[model samples]
Target: MIALVTAALAPGIALLSYFYLRNEYESRTFTQVLRAFIIGALLVFPIMVLQYALEAESIFEAEWLHAFVGVAGLEEFFKWFLLYFAIYRFVLFQSRYDGIIYGVALSLGFASAENVMYLMALGIDSAIGRAFLPVSSHALFGVVMGYYMGCAKKSDPNNFKLWISLSLVVPIILHGVYDLILLTIHENVMFIIVPFMFFLWWFALSRTKKANEKMA
Candidate 1:
């Protein structure tokens, strides 16, 4: 059980540390980041309940709808909402890169909790694949979300809406597409999933670089 818990949480903790350390300008307090992470981790239960309700009601009959709207939509929407309401207004959220840090904190929190619950139910043999896939993907998605949100924080009123919209919409799309690919593709799943993950890494890193550059 200890091993399972460790395996489940290690990826998210490692990823969160990596992104948190990337802040070059201002550093956020550990409390603030941990708060965001806890908030994110707590989101899992509500989302699961919602997803289960939708499934029970047969609200989404199609796989695409399930992936895009049912899964990604609910997950990203809640994260975006919390990030906006919970951490966005913090005075400590001073740097553009801070958005990335908090975003990662929130995302990995959710991912870590979800991973643990999943492994607990399914067993630890799948832990390695999950660390590389779902856990890492959540971190990347957070980067994209946080990058635009950081922009939104600093943008003029005219562009604030645009950045904020991208902050939510873009992550939903990326997450939706990711789920869609997994749901639709059965044979040789890695062939497509691997490239998509590569794209996510490239896009996320570029966003990270740009955010850092803006800070500099």
Candidate 2:
């Protein structure tokens, strides 16, 4: 059981640490990051309940709708809400890269919990795949979300709306497409997913670099 828990959480912890420690300009205290993580972890339960309710009601009959609206929409919306309301105006959020740090923390928090539950049901053999795919994907999605959020924080009133909207919309779209690909492609899913993952990594790293450069 202990091993199982460790296996489930290790990937998320590693990713979270990578993003958190990469900030050179201003550092956020552990408490601030942990608070966001805990809040994000707590979000999984409500989101699960809501998803279950949606499923029970047959609210979304089509697979595409379920993937885009039911799953991606709900998950990203709550994460965005928390980032915008709970962490946006934080005292330590003075630096542009801080958004990436908090975003990664919250995302990995949720992803870690979700990964644990998934591994418990599917067993340990699935851990590697989950780590590479779902967990990493969540972190990348957070990068995209956080990048725009950081922009919104530093933007003028005229541009604030655009950045903030992209913060939510971009993640939803990327997450939705990710789910759609997995749901629709049964055989050789990795063929498509691999390239997609590569794109995510490149895009996320570029965003990270841009945010860090802006800090200078």
Candidate 3:
């Protein structure tokens, strides 16, 4: 039982820890971050219901369409909504880096819950694979979303629209590609997930630096 719990939680916690350390502002309280994470985990229930409904309706028959529009689109949009509505207007969101903090908190929350479900159903081997892929993939998506959200917050009123759009759109694109590659899962295409993950890590780290610079 302990091992299962650890398998369920470790990936998300590790990713969240890394991002928490990256947060220079440290303006948000632990309670606030916990609230964001709880909100995100709570949201998974509804999202899963929707995804199951879609699968029941055979909406996932077209793999690319399902991976991109259905799965990635639905997941990212809701995650975006959770961040935008739950924390975007909060007073503590003063620094540009706050978005990344909140974004990772929420995204990791979702990932943790999702990871538990997969681990329970598919066993530890699946959990091991997910730790390296799905959990971190969601974290990368969070970084992309948060970076734009930070920009949106700091941008001129005229540019707010563009940054806000990117906050939602970029994650959807990255998530879509990530899911598509995994869904395809061919011997030939298997090599692609590696380079893609590397790029995601590099991109997320660069975004963190940029957000830190904005804070400075």
Candidate 4:
């Protein structure tokens, strides 16, 4: 069990550390980051309850609604809320890069808990797939979300709305499309999944660089 949890959590922590180290302008204290991460982890329960309620009512029967509205949209919104309410408004959030840092911290927190549950249910063999796909995907989604929020943070008054809107919308789209593809998985679809993941990584790294530039 210990090993199982370690396998489940390692990737998320690694990703969290990577993002944390990128904060060149202002270093956030460990306590601040830990608060965000713990809050994010706690959010998974409520999100799961809401998702279960939606599923119980047959809300997830429709593929598009399930993937887009139910899963991706709902999950991302809660994470965004955590950042907006809990972390975004904090005084430590002085630069655009700080958004990405906190955003990834929250996301990895969510991913870590989710991964543990999945690995426990599915057994250790599933760890490799979960680590690469769901865990890393959440990190990527967080990057996209944070990048826009970072833009919103640094935006002139007039541009705040646009960047804030993108902060939510872009992640929902990427996550929705990602879940939508997996929902329809078949033998030949591996081709699409690989390229899509590659694209997500590329987009995430590019945005990461841009966000880091703000610190410079």
Off by over 4 Å in 2: none
Which digits, one per residue and each the tens of the lDDT, describe model 4 over residues 44-159?
88999999999999977989889999999999999998888888777366777777887888899999998888888999999988888999999999988888898888768699
lDDT of 2 by residue, 34-135 (tens): 998888889989999999999999998899999999999999999999998899966456666888888888998999999989999999999999999999
What TM-score does each of the candidates earn? 0.97, 0.96, 0.95, 0.95
- Whole-model Cα lDDT of every candidate shown, in order: 0.92, 0.90, 0.87, 0.87
lDDT string, candidate 3, 1-216, tens digits: 779879889988888888988777657788888888888788889999999999999977998998888889999999999899889877466677888888898999999999888888888878878988889999889988988998888767699989999999999989999989988887776589989999999999999999888532
- Candidate 4 wrongly placed segments (more than 4 Å): none
For candidate 1, write residues 105-148 as lDDT tens digits.
99999999999999999999999999999999999999999999
The regions of model 1 sitting more than 4 angstroms off are none
TM-score of 4: 0.95
Kindly indicate the candidate among 2 and 3 with the higher lDDT: 2
Off by over 4 Å in 3: none
**TM-score of model 3 relative to the true fold?**
0.95
